[model samples]
Structure formats: structure tokens, C-alpha cells
Target: MTNQVQIWTVIAGLGIGTLFIRYSFLGLLGNRELPEWFLRHLRYVGVAILPGLIAPLILWPEATGGSPDASRILATIAAITIGVWKRSVVGTVVAGFGVLYAVQYFTG
Candidate 1:
């Protein structure tokens, strides 16, 4: 069907675009030491990206039909607390998921 073909075309285009974006930096910076200023800024990339990716999901979750849910809010708080206290990615994820399931179990 034409719709299926269009979907596949879009998927392929996205895959290629993501690949090129990832490879561009590696290829362009091969065997080169980045400047200290650039390296310092790069350290904040994850810090910036994590909050950007999470804020929307916490504030307007798709599962809740874009509504703010208590479970998600509490879980996000717990995750942030654990992340700040323990400074561990795995710990933060575990705490978030655990709190989410616990809240869902009790509330639902």
C-alpha cells in the first residue's frame, strides 16, 4: 500500500539522518583533541538533555493522556532526590521505577 511505503520511507529517512548526525562528529573530530572549553561544555550536555527529555514526560505523560498524574510526579521527585543524593544513574532509574510501580499499585 502507498501508506505503508510512505511509513517505511519516513522510517528509513529518520534512521539515515540519525546515523549521519552521530557519525558526523566522530568523522570530523577523528584523532583530534578537543579544546578545553569545548570539553567543559560537553560535560553539561547530558545534564541538559536528561532534564529536557524528562520534564515533558513528567509534566504531560502520554500514558495519562497528557494529564499530570500523582504517581509520575512523585516518582520524578524521588528520582531527582536519589540522583542528587547518591549521584548514581542506576540508582535514580531504579528509584523512579520502584516509586512509580508502588504508587500505581496503591492508587490504581
Candidate 2:
């Protein structure tokens, strides 16, 4: 078990580190206009980040003890199919969740 002093020290260190990391971006570059190329590339940050964030949950869900679950896999497929066929974000999400719940309901 960690002592109170050590725990507070670590917490304070992390707070300071997070502050600096955020300040380095907002404080330093907040005034300057970013280049067009950088801005253009930044548009895809969401495209990259969404998959990076969601892939692990679908592929190795903690609910399944780090193994892939069929319901989630089928949901992903349904979502992809809806995304490709309808090209609608809302439709894709609805399809994914709808399939996920339906599969889990039937399977479980």
C-alpha cells in the first residue's frame, strides 16, 4: 500500500504534467494560425481516432475477458454494412446498436 504523502505527490505530479501538456498546445500555438496542410490533415484526426478508440473494445472487449464476442463482431459488420450502403452516420450507429442488443438478447 502507498503512503498518503507518496499518493498525494504522485497525484500532484500527474496534475502538473497534464497542465503542462495542455498548455503547450493551447498557450503556445493558440495565437498562431496553423498552416493549411496541417489543418487539412487535422480533419482526418477524428477518422483516425474513432477507430483507434473503438477497435479494441470490439476486438477484445473486457466484458468477454479480452476475447472477441460474436454479438459485437456482428454489430460491427452490421454497422459497416449500413455505413457503406446508406452512408449515414446515424443509420450506422443505430444499426450497430440494434444488432448488438438483438444478438445479445438471442444469444444470452
Candidate 3:
């Protein structure tokens, strides 16, 4: 396949897969109450996925060509510490980006 065809094929596949995943939950079970155990587990899903999402960016940022950067690492640490101490989402995000920008600016 041509590059454009290949890209469109992948995009269409991902769209269909995402729609199916959403429909499986909302279309089939939207009105029903999920089991207590399931609900409890679901509550932690975001918390679990967040670290997985952030870890790669911190450990091997694309900007650094997949090498670990000190600024990103320190920012992550600051963000985690602020999150634990303040328990504030806004505070955590502010601290993380703030540290990331400040360190990058000063060090470079």
C-alpha cells in the first residue's frame, strides 16, 4: 500500500476500535449499575493509567531523541511531591510544568 493508504487504514482501524470499546461500555451497559467490585477497580483506573502515560515522557522524552533528560526527571519528582503534599491537581500540574520550564531555561 502507498504511505497515505497505509496511514488512512490505520486511522480507520483505530477509530473503529475506539468506537467499539466505548459502545461496549455505554451502549450495552449504560443503564445498569456496575458491580461494586468493578466500580471500585474502575475508580483507580485513572490513577493507574496516569503514571503509565507520564512515565515515558519523563524517562525518554521525544524532544531529547529518547534519552532521559534531567529537567524532565526533576519536574516529575516535583510534581509527585506536590501532588502528595497538596493533593491538588492544579497544584501538581502547575508545579510540574513550572519546574520543567524553569529548569530547562536556567540549565540551558
Clashing residue pairs in candidate 3 (N, C-alpha, C atoms within 3 angstroms): none
lDDT of the candidates, in the order given: 0.94, 0.98, 0.95
Q: Which stretches of candidate 1 lie over 4 Å from their true place?
A: 2-22
The superposed Cα distance between candidate 1 and the true structure at residue 7, in angstroms, equals 8.9
- For model 2, residues 7-57, the per-residue Cα lDDT tens digits are 999999999999999999999999999999999999999998999999999
**Candidates sorted on lDDT, descending:** 2, 3, 1
Best candidate, TM-score: 2
Off by over 4 Å in 3: 1-20
lDDT assessment of candidate 2: 0.98
Task: Estimate TM-scores for all models.
Answer: 0.77, 0.79, 0.77
RMSD value for candidate 1 = 3.0
After superposition, the stretches of candidate 2 with alpha carbons farther than 4 Å from their true spots are 85-87
Clash pairs, model 1 backbone: none
Task: Give the lowest summed-lDDT range of ten residues in model 3.
Answer: 1-10
Tens digit of per-residue lDDT, candidate 3, span 2-105: 79989999999999999999999899999998899999999999989988997898888899999999999999999999999999999999999999999999
